[model samples]
Target: MSVRTMNRRAVLLAGGASLLLAGCTSTSAPARVALAAAPETPKSPDSVPPHVQAMYAAVMDEPYPIRASRMHLVPERFWRQEVTDPTGEKPGSVVVDTTDRFLYHVRDDGTAMRYGVGIGAAGFEWSGRAHIAYKREWPTWTPPSDMIARHPELERYRHGMEPGPDNPMGPRALYIHQGNVDTLYRIHGNPDETTIGKAVSSGCVRLLPQDVIHLHANVVSGSPLLVV
Candidate 1:
């Protein structure tokens, strides 16, 4: 997925959007289809329109490392967690280290599975603990009033936007709540790859499509999350 710049000056495409994991030594190839056909793979930047390129440049300062292997498309190191046995905590365990832009799933042997994420900006961020009160697959997006006030163009979709490739919430979303109050934040998939490791979101933490799917499958409703 791609995001418009904070200044609304450019658009930035998310990482892992248009890539295919063939082999580490394989040459970069052009995208074979439109975004909807393959949400996991994105068209090569060079094949993207000039406007798209221009928009991407404004929102992103740099690009994510292109990792490839014969067996895996992305290296585990990008997310920065050591994988342990997945048996201990089948559910109800989460950790978000905001300082490092990582969210981890605790495992049985004391190790964790970590993923890179995009965090909220100043004045719109949240920390501390929350629970995964709900989970939605391809959730609709309803930009908050504050977000709409900041960007009037979003007013048309205030009610809710349908779930699909263009929707900001890609693949899955886990709502965070504190007691009975919904935190209005989520752990969801991002459209822009470069947002990871950067403070570019409103409040919710963003993850890659593949990683988000992986985590979504592991986490259950009412799970505890520690964000420090």
Candidate 2:
């Protein structure tokens, strides 16, 4: 195979989203097919729209290297964009519609910033209202006991894995809580670019690393979040 194909496959499998934590341990798509249609592979940044490339641009100053996501891997609809407020909950409210796999952060204006998120498996999902208790930059990752049982090698990280590119938590993590109680779920970053809009994870919602950074800066402690 060509070098480009190899690179695309490598990126898709690198730290896949399913291996991410179902809990905050420490830190931290849809498609159509047509007959004879060209296979849909992740697109190079230059081949994608300029806005998308800009939105997911690589970080120059992050402690760990955070390359821009393969924007084309995710449906264009899931790419971070603004839309009219449909929740009407209130400004500054963060809403996650797991059914539609969309997260909306209502702005003071009528528009809300919508992001596509990869949710967890069935029977492992969390819904209802919660709040962002705090935020972490490159937060450490601690594999829960159950996870360790499944992958004994993770026992080494029982204490917590140092934050870095390889850390599944990516470069940012938002701790979700319900009234001072750690819900054990998080809205965190995933360096893997392929899991943005599919149900491929354990439970925690995963956002592209770049998109999470944008969200991490705008939100504050106690930001109300509704997962429906």
Candidate 3:
């Protein structure tokens, strides 16, 4: 080929290579930018509200580690929050509204720390004035005689089920009593977060383990409990 034609061909090839490199660099730049700008996975408790963070920290700082596994992701609506007290009960009173599946811890400032709860199933529902006679941490589970009768599979646990993650009483329990008599009802923790905001228990009020840990730490024995 002619010298001039050879020079032109070399120039064209060099220009094409430059454009190809430029295209590759431009395409990769956006990918790098997207990775850098991508949002981070939110940190546990920290990404939650201030009050929730405080409660979460309190639970985790306990003598026994309330591990992350114990923390279940519940619906945003069911997450604990301080709302204007709807019930006119006196401060420090625990008012459980079965119809709404919410447990309210009345505060003096006209606000209540509301937590979602699971109430007794239709036939087993109970509502009346009661008091927290006592409290237990990692309480044992003893299936009642009637409960055992209905589900013979529970006969093995008739004696007692030791306190642990699998126990019906998740991390804490508050025994409800009418005067000196045991009402055979309780406010306790349940590991199943899906049950919250539903009526699926056998006359017991169930809260999430994290929430129960917070409530257990704050509520005192002898606290009046009104289930309505």
Instruction: Report the Cα RMSD per candidate.
Output: 15.9, 11.3, 26.5
lDDT winner, 1 or 2: 2
Candidate 2 lDDT trough over 10 residues, lowest sum: 28-37
| Cα-based lDDT at residue 201, candidate 1 | 65
Whole-model alpha-carbon lDDT for candidate 1: 0.57
User: Which segments of model 1 are wrong by more than 4 Å?
Assistant: 1-77, 84-91
What is the model-wide C-alpha lDDT for candidate 3?
0.66
Stronger candidate by TM-score (1 vs 3): 3
Could you say which candidate leads in lDDT?
Answer: 2
Report the C-alpha lDDT of model 1 over 1-228, residue by residue, as the tens digit.
Answer: 111221121112111112111110000112122111111323354444454333223322113221221112222234434555232334347866566566778775667777777676544456655679988877888777766766677777779888766677776899887778776788887655655665666667888765676689888899877665
How are the candidates ranked when ordered by TM-score, highest leading? Answer: 2, 3, 1
RMSD after Cα superposition, model 3: 26.5
Most accurate candidate by TM-score? 2
Output the better candidate (1/2) by TM-score: 2
Could you tell which candidate, 2 or 3, scores higher by lDDT?
2
TM-score of each: 0.63, 0.80, 0.72
Clash total of candidate 2: 0
